[model samples]
Target chain A: MNDTIGITALVPPELMYACGKRPLDVNNVVPVSSSSPSNKLCAWTAIWRDMILNGGLDIDSLVVVAGGDCHNALVDGQKAELSGMPTHYFFYPFDGDTDYLRSQLEKLVRFLGGIQDERMFSLISDLKAKGRALDELRVNDRARGSDVFSALISFSDLAGNPDIFGKTLDSVPRTDIRYSSRVALIGVPPIYPDFHETAEGFGLHVVYDELPYEFLRLGGSSLDSLASSYRDYSFAGPLKNRVRLIQDELLRRRVDGVIHYTQYACHHTLEDEIFRQHLDYPILTVQGDLPRPSTEQLKLRLEAFAEMLGVMS
Target chain B: MNIGLDVGSTTAKIVHVEEREVIFSKVVPSHHWTELIDDGQDDRCIVSTGYFRKKVPHCAAITEITAASLGARYHNPETQVIIDIGGQDTKVIDLRSNTFVINDKCSAGTGAFLELAAHYFDIPVGSLGRLHSLATKGAQLNNTCGVFAISEMISQLVSGYSMEEVIYGLHQAFALKISQMVPSADTVMLIGGTVRNTGIIDAINNVLDSKIEVPGAPQLVNALGAALYRERLDDGR
Candidate 1:
């Protein structure tokens, strides 16, 4: 690929595997500078900028999501673009009952030319296929009862590794483990996938979540569906709808318990009290910041919750 | 003539009055203070308060929110409660006879939240209220903290809510947060810079589910109250 077409991934998330271009978080290449320009900015923005400037991420092409700290990720994309890199921003809209991801994958594939389209599509198809294989793996282990614990323990391999994601899923037995406790992983997006794997390892299954995969998604046919509905609704109406979605998910999932992951100085996520009255299940909150949590700490928390579920039963 | 100046985090306001007749009043950009205060124009007494009050050049008196509350209550004894939200902080003042009590800490439901939301929406700070009022819908802006609210706003918008609704949701979330900080009271009058934004008042009304009365030029209520304090001290002198 020409250097001009070289890509610098600015926190693209899962779409990276679907897009055929290289994936690199800006923070991984840059160092965080003093936040004089961002003092007026929110903590998430400040942290993201600091990561890009300080983390020393390397990239030539930039892709950014439409919402979250990623909204401003485009600013970094703009800078990279100015430096001669090609950039694109992908939007995800909410109109339940449609597959936004598959369409986004198609747009991403078309943008990159046909070179990587097959590989990206194949990866997605592979994951879906593995989802079934994973079900089969779990069925066999559950039939064996005690080995179900081993299958669950093997699930932690999925975090940040797509191959592991597939392998772990394929490793679980399809049959429901008898007396297998259920827990809900609620925290950072990364932690959710990893913790879900760990839950399986502990002979407990996480049936619901508050992670990005469980909630915020971009599913629709057109680019218009990717943007916010600012032009479509009034101030309070759209917001009320957003709240109702969260409420609906929580109620619909019917998970056994919730574990809230909180970031320090993150003002918005900590508003547990605001949503506390809306919840019915027992909630366990854990606080941490990233480069990801220490493995030992995560293991302990996961196991403790699993034990708690076992006791409740 | 007496003057009161309130310096907030994002903007500043000066109120000049002579014997109850209002003179000149202006809301100036916060960082451009030197342009307005040059030459020390007058010998009259001037009192100041709020976040940027200390940044003001050569002033006669500087009082805390507590004293300002008393001063405002003294001028308008009908005032039973004070709801003041500045550019970066918020205060709920409870009046009991001659004294006023203020909230203990600065977090949640303050101007800081609005400032955060403005940046989140990529909108100018002063235009927040207008934008908020224009929003026809609302997203549940997770007002858990300033940091989280930004992320939550993005997530909410991604999920199909509008930016205006997200911004308005934040305002409502913030108003609700501040209202909970206040103890029960009646005939409440809102003060401080944020009170100038009718959208904020509307959000507060929804939060409190009651009517709130604000003085004309609500931002000056603090400065006017400070002027009242200067008058009280002069009487004692």
Candidate 2:
């Protein structure tokens, strides 16, 4: 079998070349598969559970990048293990220093069955190539001060495919999208593909934030990691980190506004609510789910809020 | 006017029933039941309910929240379940025939959680729900207990999640917590102060995966139901 087993939410392209494993994103598999067994849980929970139950979740190892509060993935992993499956949880802490990320990758490699010397070399080369490509694209899209609203759309499209992310970055017109105000996309990373695009269409520039990619990184101070290790629940670290991430985004961005998207019943939106009030600029709150105040209602509310900001400005 | 006065821990509500129809209603603070007596609006048969049932001045009779709950259901015989999430406590009433059984022993996952969160945020409790419309993204809270929720809210604040998200999360957590209390039967109705918070309603709908009836002026349904009960009794006696 040429395919080494791995599970991912959104596939990071380097994983395929570096590890020689087929990156299986469970979300993609579940839509095409059967989910009758997951009726006991809520609709959202059922979607992920069906992914696991149908063997779409078969992975020799799991690498969860930080973002999108992957509670669905982790919960499904627990259920899978109970039903007999091999899995591991990895944190991509937000610190961004590659050393800790590399070590964490090393541990994952060993756990998955040792990174061969040749494979390690290939992996580094793969990361370098991907990094270079990303940098070039980022530079060309350097119309940074230009309307960054489209960059958000490009970012939203980037969720599922790195190649598409690369391509979408290339396609965003360098037209002068006059710099409006800068805002932060706060709360439970956008796992959904069109989230950024939807927000960007509303004439706001969103810097990526409080996402799994940003919060789930494994490079935080060892003190926090050590603290998490002593905790009884697997979700404790992620939960605590989420609060920290939102705070950091608020401080770092000098953000003019915040757009909070939280899943209903997540209990995390409480933090964002408090944060929204303290911000000097306007804040737009969006509660996401399949039902209730429908998308149209949310859009109207957001538009009205943006108009209110326009009036005040 | 046949009036049913419900003296709650925080608010006093009175419904004026004339010939089986409620003509007017007043909600005042529990401390101001004397204000109703001071108005010189007497000669009306009074039925009282709520935590401070004994406090209603010139009341002809008093009943518990459970009795009022049952009375409300009796008025609307079609009501299968009654949910009351108030300031200090939460009630999940299972209405069967004419009897209503209440879950009043626990205050951990009720509207007290909201009050605790509001105090922690130091905002007027009435103003909490208005912030949901302003949120674009929200942070989540993880408080399962009412008393300890204050500490959890504080931790979330220190950690940097916005107060709106914390409040929304508290409601979401509550909906999830209360969902298990819902009977398998349908037509569940929500009552009490928490019903005024749409965020909680959305959260509950998310958990129940179905729409529950929330009448207009939902907070007054219990008092209205009490008034209807007095109307029936006065005609019979």
Give the interface RMSD of each candidate: 23.2, 22.0
lDDT of 2: 0.53
Lowest-sum lDDT 10-residue window in model 1 chain B: B97-106
Off by over 4 Å in 1: A1-313, B39-42, B52-60, B97-107
Residues A1-313 of candidate 2: C-alpha lDDT, one tens digit per residue = 4344445443232334344454555544332333444343323445655556565555555554333335555666666667666666665444443455456555665655543334433333333344334333322334332233333322311333444544554564544343345566666543344555455555555544444322122111232332232221122344454555555656655555666766655556566546544544455656654322235435434443443333223
Model 1 C-alpha lDDT versus the unseen true structure? 0.52
Task: Report the TM-score measured on chain A for model 2.
Answer: 0.60
Question: Which of the numbered candidates is closest to the native, going by highest lDDT?
Answer: 2
User: RMSD (Cα, Å) of candidate 1?
Assistant: 19.9
Q: Top DockQ: which candidate number?
A: 2
Model 1 Cα lDDT, one tens digit per residue, A1-313: 3211222222222334434454544332112233333442333344444444443344454555443334444565465456555666654443421255345545655665534333443454455444434333433333332233333322211233556656665554456454355445444332222444555676655544343322113222222332232122111123345445556655654556666655544543645554444555555555444434235445544554554344322
Residue-level lDDT tens digits of model 1 in B154-180: 898889987778878888888877877
Q: Candidate 2 docking: what grade? A: incorrect
Each candidate's DockQ = 0.01, 0.02
